[model samples]
Target: CLSSQHTEGNVGTKSEEKLIELIPLIISCSREKHIWKHIYVFLTPGLKWHSAGVVRPTLTVLPPSKEEDKQSSATVVCLATGGFPSNWKLGWTVGGTSTSSGVSTSLEVLGTDGRYSWSSTLSLSADQWRKAGSVSCEASLSGQSPVTQTLDPDHCSE
Candidate 1:
């Protein structure tokens, strides 16, 4: 028992019966008002619709925790947040050389605002971290230019 109404407005609402049925579920949540506000905002017109697909992400390099052992390795994490489409490539390079060892990437997490966040980590030995040249993390998607963040390995000195 479902029905959809087509209006000139940019947003639409579910049938009254469906909303009544959803009341119980909404009441159990703390964000009921917030959810309803979004519904209302969606149903009304006169608002500009911005496409999230072209939104560029903000990139960050999380500071790595220091390791006391010279033989031990440290993890460098790069995070890209607030992007759309949920498909992005993350690659690691050390001194202009592509290195795939000790790398881990997480699946993109979709946010409530329709954007996404992704993260990748690379492990580097203490010697490599202290003596290596440039380390870069690149994030890319089809049809869009890639975004890169570079870090100096020498800056990781203990």
Candidate 2:
């Protein structure tokens, strides 16, 4: 996880505003002789105001209860919060086989701080889930191991 954070430095009073003409930053305030102020500037090159953090994903199998031993469809929805400046890939895995047609992914929505919150859903037939196979939602990012969560059809229906 690559995160950029800046902390406020101790500034003493009796200081005057200093600006390099070559730089593009604009300071609107002047420091008094007896006052001190600390400022923290946060910015990311590819991502804005990013915090280095890993996302812990939550899984919801909708139509929560379903019929058993029958062919039906259910939704495997995953919601992840608090991931930074990275793209995520979500897929549907049935009995450890990845299904491309059964998966549909969504774009990342901008968060309050300009970070991203993402959601992806996979709809599969009931038989695939009921076969005692594993249905998983995996959130993939660069340089980090993907976070995967599994749902059990039998246990989910009960």
Candidate 3:
């Protein structure tokens, strides 16, 4: 069993005396049919608790990537040209928030073979784009974290 004890000043320590507890199971191997079944084992342990305070989780925001930091300002525009067959929703995030207004989404275009494509655009003046925290073209699939491409001021206007 795995166990730990914590003290006010120290992080929890694992119990070394009984570090392992084993559970056994009967198993059969196709390649070793003559052996019939072999014994399989696993270890599980009980955890101990202590009074030492736990560290609080700190919120961490990743800095915009180096490339993105440059794409700011100038006539800002966002585009999603393809990948519609996957039902990817395209949108923007500015100053760490999702934005729907000040944007225009296009109608889906269907290809001859049942595939589709779509585009969305978010525009801003050069000055506003420079000072804004971030400009992101986010593509999200249902029930999944969005994959975003951040446009940095350096990549923009220039």
Candidate 4:
């Protein structure tokens, strides 16, 4: 069963009191066969609100690994961190064109501070990387502007 409660309090030294609702989320996990356990969780205060209070994610674009630079192909990674909720999506673009082939995205990882982090990787051939003008990583959420980070291949060091 799910229960909700409405509460009001002052947040961050503001004189006005904010109204927040507490919604219980129940998760079930099984440690062994036929053995099931349930855990009840509640979101932090600021996260209890709707999209108006959504936390934007910080994006970082990492250059190609040194080991991969020695090979025929190269890989770049994009990491998005400190976003609220787990519904954000990560996408990649190479030279201003959206590229999905040889791309991999990881599942959202929930942090103890009530935020989420995710990562995406893009793989390209050595020849392609050299000529590729710019690579971008964008994190998108519904009803919000996407956060994008761009990296120039020419600026990257071996």
- Winner by lDDT: 4
- RMSD after CA superposition, every candidate: 12.0, 12.0, 20.0, 11.8
lDDT of 1 by residue, 42-154 (tens): 21122232333256688887646764334477678999998755677788988889889989999987665656799999888866766658788888888789888888866
Q: What C-alpha lDDT does candidate 1 achieve relative to the native structure?
A: 0.64
Candidate 3 ranges with C-alpha deviation above 4 Å: 1-75, 81-86
How much does candidate 3 score in TM-score?
0.45
Model 3 clash tally? 17
Q: Candidate 2 — what's its lDDT?
A: 0.53
C-alpha lDDT values of all predictions: 0.64, 0.53, 0.48, 0.74
**Tens digits of lDDT, candidate 3, 1-158:** 11223122444344556353222333334544544432222222444421111111111112333354456423334444434233566677876888787777667653332234565666655456667667777766664566667766544443
**lDDT for 49 (candidate 2):** 30
**Candidate 4 on 1-158: residue-level lDDT in tens?**
22223223421221134333223433224434544322223344344432223678999999887788788788999999998657889999999999999999999886646678999999999878878899999999887899999999998986
Q: Which candidate wins on TM-score?
A: 4
| Candidate 2 TM-score to native | 0.57
Which residue pairs come into collision in candidate 1? none
Query: Model 4, stretches more than 4 Å misplaced?
Result: 1-41, 44-52
Give the alpha carbon lDDT tens digit for every residue of 1-158 in model 2.
11123223422222133311111122324445433322222342343332234354434434324442344766677776656543666666767877776666778765555355777777666666568467777777766677777776656645
lDDT value, candidate 3, whole model = 0.48
Model 2, C-alpha of 11: deviation from truth (Å): 17
Clashes within 3 Å, all models in order: 0, 1, 17, 0
Sort the candidates on TM-score, descending order: 4, 1, 2, 3
